[model samples]
Target: MPRNNDLNIILGDLKSLFSIAAVLMSAMVVSSLLFWELRSAAGFIAGMLVSLIIAAAIHSITPRSEALELKHAIIIAALAYLLIPAVSAIPYMISTGMSPVDAYFESISGWTSSGFTMLPAPDSIGHSMQLWRSVTQWIGAVGVILLMVTVLIRPGTSAYILYQSEARKERIRPSIRSTVRTIWKVYLALTIISFFILLLAGMPAWDALNVSMTAIGGGFTLYSDSIGHYDSLPIEIVLLPVMIAGAIPFAVLFMMFKLKLHTMIYDIQVRTFAGLIATGCLLLVAQNYFYFYNDLFSATRYSVFQLVSAITSTGLQTTDISGWSPTALLIMSIAMIIGGCAGSTSGGIKVAREIFLVNQIKLWLKKTLLSKKAVIVIRLGQHKVVEKTITEELNEATLISFLWILNILVSIMLLANILGPEVSLSNLIFEVCSAQGNCGLTTGIINPAISPLAKLIFIADMWMGRLEIVPVILLLRTVFRGFGR
Candidate 1:
């Protein structure tokens, strides 16, 4: 891989990316007009032009064909994530009086598909902004880099590097481009189906469109009350499968599309996540029934929806959990921490890493107990992982999960000092995990009134989680020590 060639190609690729983002924002221009929001339309126009200017400035270097190093991939991904939100927040600033920091925070939240919000009320944001946010969530969930590479970059070493830098890997096709195109098709198809289903379930057309777009992208509500706004069982039921689909790895869905159910069921990630969901739902139901809801039906209803929301990092809410017991909240926190499958829109440490950790641990224990001549391997279904891959997976998983938990703990301590005395220890734990896991369930601690430092802390957590921790570290290291090859 020629380092200079990699640099030129990635730069050229990013320039094309920002241009693409501006083109997509055109829909929001029309969206603003449809909603009769002249101010927002102007903001969208301004934002589009500014992004195009920035793209034009990125360079006219003709990309040379070469492989991109992991470091370059990380740098490009981290910078792209940071830069786009800064530009996209313009509409929020112009349409409403939200300060720069507030607007950027909201924009990044949508960009990460982590739906924690500072809005005091839904009416506070224009309907056009709401539509833009939902659209951004859909794009962000699909991944900024994946969208870019699929559109213009050809399949190659650089393409896969850019794609996986978004915290996703696993090819659904022979090449990165094909896989992404298939994923885009699947994602859009699901969004359309979800939109119609929500409409059928009694949501207004506009509301259905927004909710389905966000929900199918593993984002929560544009409304203040989240899923609770409707309180309709049919709506809840329809959304469960959509959220599940959103959180499922596109490869898994691709396998399903190919009718490979037998292989999927035996996959370690599938089994482990299913076990986690079942246990979480049961524990939550018992706690809610015995302590809060008092009725079996009511407990089960909230338990299923909230548990799926937490595990999928979807953040849709049917009821508040503020009054729930510490035990109940802990269960929800655990679900959020585990989150959905790797290569999915949802966040947290991911199901693939969790199973990898468990398998490695089992392999270690078995090795210590077994005879010297014994043969052993960690198997996922009919496949055996090679030792080198196992070592890499373990190293990556342990490192990222450690940094992830560290970020959560630090945020908790900071918030404990900043928030009210009445804010319990459990709620603080829940809040930080929600932010860092990119799981947006809240205990009411997030607000525009919160101190800037607190807001910044949550903002940083979302960025790190969405980038999967390592890239942020790589970027910070580059800033201090200078860029490394």
Candidate 2:
């Protein structure tokens, strides 16, 4: 690619993101109006105008391009993830009176769909601000690039690359525009349906909308107690499927909705994901029953909900996570780290990767134990996975897991040094996993009182987790080299 072209691609991609931000700002403006927040509405309108101007200026300067290479897509996607949240932080600072760093932290957390918050009293956040938070997660759920593809980009190779770069690997339609449109259709339909269900379950309309967005995005809630704030079994039941839907691939959901239920049911990844959740829940129930709560009903209720929440990376806590026994917390932490299926809104290592890694190990052991000349095959579902394919998948999975652990360890050190010895190591590990997995469950460690440096680490974790380590690292390397070809 020509140097100028690369610059143009980056600028153009960023322009699209800012354009989306402008639209989100308009929604926030309306939200502000609904809440009678005059200053907040004015601030959002001003932000929207500035974003539009920047977007237009970039579009005017950048040369027209029909295609973007994978590198271009990665760079653009990475930069957009970083920059979009900075723009999103404006409302937090404006409405919540949080410090600039804290506000940016909140925005990054929301944008990454990682439910960590610096707010001392989440319920005290302005209504518009709370809605904006949910909206950001909703946008981040599918991604900004998907929105751009639907509204801004023409159907082309560039659009597809950008779509894939946003961690969306499947297409439900032939054309990029059609695919994005269909995806938005499914997403919107689910959001509306889930909102109504929550409403029928007795939640206020406003809360319903917020939870619908948050649940679909696999994001934690604005309420400090999360889903437990409702204290209604019906509401929890209403949200369960919505969160699960977020964890399932949109493509699979699209197929299932089209009456191809076998496509999702027989999927190896889906089966493994479902099995993992079920097993985790059972183990947690036993652990809680034996160690924490003597009552089976109480143990099962809390255990099942939190286990599902953690596994799906939804972060809607139904129990006090801090009070969980060490064994139970460890199980939940592992579930969070394993995460949901690939190409879904849920984050973490993803069950697909974990399954691949396990299969690779099995293949290696079989080959070793049988004979040096033994031919080995790894199968995922009914399809035979070739050695080269399995190797690549294993490499990708292991490298990502290593990086995830390294980042968490670094963050843990930072937290311990800043928060002192009183901070529980297990809780810190749990919190770090939550951030890195985009699993919003926390042990009450996240708040405004934390050190500024620690907050920056958490911000980086959320960003890194959402981008899955590769794109962000590549983007950083590209920056370090001054974008040299």
Candidate 3:
């Protein structure tokens, strides 16, 4: 009876998860029919039907619950995130005829908003699949749980717990429901604005729509060559701000809608993000100008856009960087690992946590060397953060950062064993960082034709990176020791 109770508890919220999931999958089915120019809607219709059957089957059995414990929240969060990508993979398998691993890799990439493409030949994929990838990025950026809050969960401890499990905590409103819906509004507005901007820049409607959705979430592009295929300065210029916008915290984005700028100017995350991008841009400009491009205009052109895309974790690129200098690649690697602001669509260690860790390091130094008399109180913004508060928050932030580095090292080791000494160590490291950081920039080592084992490693990195590591940790523990959790 106790075991049954636990099972019931676990299955509780998943009913709503699958129910809403079916609804979201239907949008792709509609999109498929809308784009009847290719394989028509058969693949999409089949994908949606399978997804609906699964949702219905799950909904029929899942026991309802009033609330979720922390463990349950983590489990539910991990399960939904993992499952949606798997179910979404059905479409790719049916339509593109990609191998299961490759198709799942493609689904995971889009759902994690990592933008890595595993499609054997992207050009041959139908328009529906193309749009599905963009939609996955858009929905993934908003989050499955956050979407759940829109129509499923009500106000309570369970609501907030489920929301936090999505790797977000910044409350833009008094209520979780209001906050998520507002974020949805902000995200929608940003995408719409980006779409029109790209359209004005002379991109075709479909291209503009895909870029708007993918760029806002820092996801993959439609073409194999990425942004470079267009070769239009206007398109690149239009996308630069959109990519950076993906990195700005949703709270700041909401403030921007209210036309608030002075307060935003004082935000440490904003300042830090700007500093990193500017520093990276100048460094890349110098390297490119002297080593490759030679022309200042051309160097700056490639430098600024690529650097912003890297820092934002947006995979769009205007050049085939397979030949870029190691120095340039390394510079972008740092940007990718540092990542964007907390609570933004972009992924990485996050700017807010980085600031906390930096301050924590200083606090430790002051106590050890400068003495307690130094009185260096840790602060995030205008507010004075208590020492205990700093310690509490810093603990998780540091743990996640450590695991992030460990994952990078492990992923690199695995890739090294597979690729051997033929590949440049710099390129290998750069590719690993890009995958784990959810920054889709390719240093040429990762591609559709890469070994299947290598693809799985990247898929793991994307999953871990998207969950920011801890939820994945909790998930593994639950899987290995159910009762222990």
Candidate 4:
């Protein structure tokens, strides 16, 4: 007795859900093969069958539409992104026997590319599960935007709206699909290049593969100590550049690929991103020289690695940053929050927004210095930004930044109430920054033995951070509206 339109909506939702399940099943199959775990293989098969059944049911029940509305697209994207991670966590729970919350935390962390893990050590988890973790980040890095552009978006305003909502406003090509394919090509090429470099740097094949995936901010390390497990300067050097590359905007990479060196070098956002990295590195190096490690080379190595890792949101660490001075830790925390450029795998507020906000502030100062009637326009790169655009950008950036602070403060209080006040506020802030930035580096607070509630909080933070909060909010709104009913 349901209307045909209502049935179609339900069917579309089911299809999207099944699609996510299929992705999880595929990952599971890969994990099963890697570990040669029969039980996991069975799980993968069962998952696939279930997904196919749902797909079949949806296909049978509903008719296809020529185009989808913006609301429909947002709903589909939100559900797909969230459900993929949730379903993917099942295998981790089964393999590691981690409590449901811990497993969800790990899965969300991986999918969000946050890299923070509750696992005790590298050897503690099976090879297959670790690989699965890496895969989740790698997939999530490209994101639902890439998928929509490739498979859904066509010419016109709908595509534009979807692109903006996806937080990838920068277009690399005339066609959205072409842009996505180019981005994917660059991403995969970098992955391959990183893999070979790591192998040459003396990592074993499996280790190289895992580290290569993680080096680009995919946030899955094969070992517990992360890049530190290799203990090789060569490996660190190899990874450092790759992490930087990951942080660079994909549109810039496409320009570089087209041999437009000026576009790559002269880009305002890229230049600012590079400048921030250099500044952060210098500060950390100075801190290390004065307090941590007096050795010049050791200090520079750790400083560069941590800076690049945080800036890129890669979260792979060569040293325990918890032992660093409070000043150094604070600097790194801020770097993590700033993150990389737009149109990249890295997360956080992003360098582009930071540049925009700074420029807006400068314009305001200029106006204040001039007569009250004077007009001022913000400038970024070669373009003069409109007042409306600047205002919106500032408002969005401020809201997100304030929300992040609030979340961090609440999390710290929760942790303090549970873990005691002995834990330094600085360390708590560092962990919060790491998780929210999707940097994956930790202050040793996230452990297998932590309280379940704490783990859930971190997981929620990672999920919110990765999606940049909007999609999750929309998903919640949809649930409250009872569309599923």
Q: Pick the candidate with the highest lDDT.
A: 2
- Candidate 2 vs candidate 4: the TM-score winner is 2
Which residue pairs in candidate 4 have backbone atoms (N, alpha carbon, C) closer than 3 angstroms, thus clashing?
122-224
How do the candidates rank by TM-score, highest first?
3, 2, 1, 4
Q: State which candidate has the highest TM-score.
A: 3
Give lDDT per model, in order: 0.82, 0.84, 0.82, 0.77
Each model's TM-score? 0.94, 0.94, 0.95, 0.90
* Predicted candidate 3 versus true structure: per-residue lDDT over 40-91, tens digit per residue: 3666666667777876776578666565677777777777777878878878
Mark the regions of model 4 whose C-alpha exceeds 4 Å error after superposition. 1-14, 27-35, 53-67, 123-126, 148-162, 481-485
lDDT of 4 by residue, 233-260 (tens): 9888888889998999988887887888
| Model 2: per-residue Cα lDDT over 1-485, one tens digit each | 33776778788778878988998899889889988988788768877888888899998899867557888888887788788888788777777677989988988888888887788777787788777888888887777777777787465877788788877777778887888888888898889999999999999888888888889755657687888888899998888888888899888889988999999878888899889988998999999999999999999888888888888888888778798788888898898888899978898889888998899889888887988776778888989977889998799889988888888788888878888898888888888899889878888888888888888888888888888888988887777664565
Ranking by lDDT: 2, 3, 1, 4
Better of 1 and 3 by TM-score: 3
By lDDT, the better pick of 2 and 3 is 2
Cα RMSD for candidates in order? 2.5, 2.1, 2.0, 3.2
